[model samples]
Target: MITHRLVRTWEVLPSGGYSTAWAELTGRRLAARGRAVGLLPEPHWVTYTLDTGDDYVTSRLRVSVDTAGGTRTVDLRNDAGRWTVDGAYRPDLDGALDCDLGLCPLTNTMPVLRHDLHRGTGGGGSGPHDFLMAWVSVPDLAVSANRQTYTPLAPDGQGVGGPRASRVRYSSGEFQSDIEFDERGLVLDYPELATALTR
Candidate 1:
């Protein structure tokens, strides 16, 4: 069976070109164990949530970094199980995942999910950096409230863990330390460490 979702996503790229993704993923009952598609692909955990009646999945992603000293990667997955993290909005962000912002579907997009985020990373000029994100099942994107320049407005959706996350722009001069996380305040992807590898 397939489950539907009103997931929330946040993608960020540092001034140095390192990308970070923060996605508040939520949906109906999902598979207990599956692969969460991301910058480097990682293992996922599926569980149930009392508030949204959805699966509160938490994934531990694998991140490899090449620093000037050497290369290292930390196994950042705690216990793979269900957790309870539902409320208004997690200011601390239950968990966060770091990845290559360029790898996010919002930048190029693929069959993983069909979307209409033509905003293109926002770098148009005199504006903020644009954000285009959509899950595979939800075609009607949650825009308007965020004033996104896209199609198929879906204003009646929640951001899974809490209130929907706002779409950020690079031009805004705002930079976040991490991206891509679960409601449990976990970090899914780590790009800062990865950038050190490329350099």
Candidate 2:
């Protein structure tokens, strides 16, 4: 990943308060400025991929919020506009934690992120394609090729948290996202990599 490294700063919201962040990504960084306002620390950053041919466009934001309960980051990914939480998940898998879950519903309108030819073109996958490239704690169930269930982050024994990473490679796209787990399969916090700082 020799791509330019981006840096951003954010403020925590007062429970239901508001927050915002900004970044300049340029030379080695690619000349980008990103800004966002939201209730949660919700990810806000400038993401530019030479592979996507968006050098001129400002990168979209994926923010991490620091709140009363804990710190969290909602990372948006791929050219399809998918989203993921990069922090202490509530352990409540009400909706499939899979980013593909959201991308599927928007397939008809999901913008095709332009990429290098080596990345391969979309073959019109039956579903929104596999956005499950993010790491999963569960492996017992087979990869359905489509967003089906809440891929457990810990299916081996008991998932709590640990130093582990789960990644789901897309079948037809250049997408990659992962979750670092504590020994218990629970998600951990990378204070250094956090998009926002708590007030």
Best by lDDT: 2
Off by over 4 Å in 2: 1-60, 79-199
Scored by CA lDDT, what does every candidate get? 0.24, 0.25
Give the Å error, residue 100, model 2: 17
Whole-model lDDT, model 1: 0.24
Best by TM-score: 1
Which 10 residues in a row give candidate 2 its minimum summed lDDT? 101-110
Worst 10 residues of 1 by lDDT: 138-147
lDDT of 1 by residue, 119-162 (tens): 22222222322332211111111111111222221223343223
TM-score of each: 0.24, 0.21
Summarize candidate 2's per-residue lDDT along 1-199 as a digit string, tens digits.
Answer: 3443334333323222222222222321232223323342332221221111142221222433333555444443333323223332322322222222111111111122211111122222223332322322111111222332112232233322322332112233333332223221112222222213321
RMSD of every candidate to native, in Å, equals 15.6, 18.4
